[model samples]
Target: MTIPEQIEAYLTSQPQAKRTDLRALHALMLQAIPGGKLWFEDGKNSEGKVVSNPSIGYGTRTTTYADGKTKEYYQAGLSANTSGISVYILGIADKAYLAETYGKTLGKATVTGYCIKFKKLADIDVEVLEAAVKDGVGMTGEN
Candidate 1:
């Protein structure tokens, strides 16, 4: 299935959800970041189209960093019924130092070379989160 489809399926299978809240939160994350073609669309990896189990809501957006590295923001389906909302930042592998430093800001964050997954939007520190995004993918923020 496509990313949108995957999101739909996942959300539908959920026993409970806060759809508006989750979507708004996701949109806020995209808006808070800097330059790129922000989009609410599917993502393709070498493996094929990304999928969100049980329709949790999957999406991908692209952004450019200050150092000239481009980054992708990917979200898994809406999982308010199970794990809440998950937001992912790409290029973690290239931003290990940033992750190491800002990783503590969230208190509980899942780290990978190219991804940081947070169980809830509130768990993220907006300032630190922006800095990490800028540092990780090289996106410069407002003055």
Candidate 2:
């Protein structure tokens, strides 16, 4: 399936309440980063073991490993996990910036180095989340 199709399938597969929440988040992400490349990760390793929740991603970034190999991934991503939803902001060099800048204002979410997570959209300040997302995109995106 295509990336969009995969994302729809992933979102639709969620439990109804979670699906509604994630769908809203997905739309928010799109509005935050319009025209960005879309991506879908099935959360599988090369061996087909499920390593994480499948994620819908936006934009692009090239990630380099300590071994000097590189891989391409999205700058922002969304996923539904066991407890809640996670929003990932990749490519930021400062590990503490996100949590430090937006944690308190983000409402009930947990702001980590690269992820902001909450049980549902209604639990957080959507505007604050949007600002954080835009901030992350600006910090990590190619100029």
Highest lDDT scorer: 2
lDDT of 2 by residue, 8-94 (tens): 899889999999999998999999998888999999999999998899998888888999999888999999999999999887889
For residues 30-53, write the lDDT of model 1, one tens digit per residue: 454433433333334557766642
Taken over the whole model, the C-alpha lDDT of each candidate is: 0.49, 0.90
Work out the TM-score per prediction. Answer: 0.48, 0.94
Weakest lDDT window of 10 consecutive positions for candidate 2: 134-143
Error of 2 at 69 (Å): 3.2
Q: Alpha-carbon error at 32 in model 1, in Å?
A: 3.0
Residue 113 deviation, candidate 2, in Å?
Answer: 0.3
Best TM-score among the predictions, by candidate number: 2
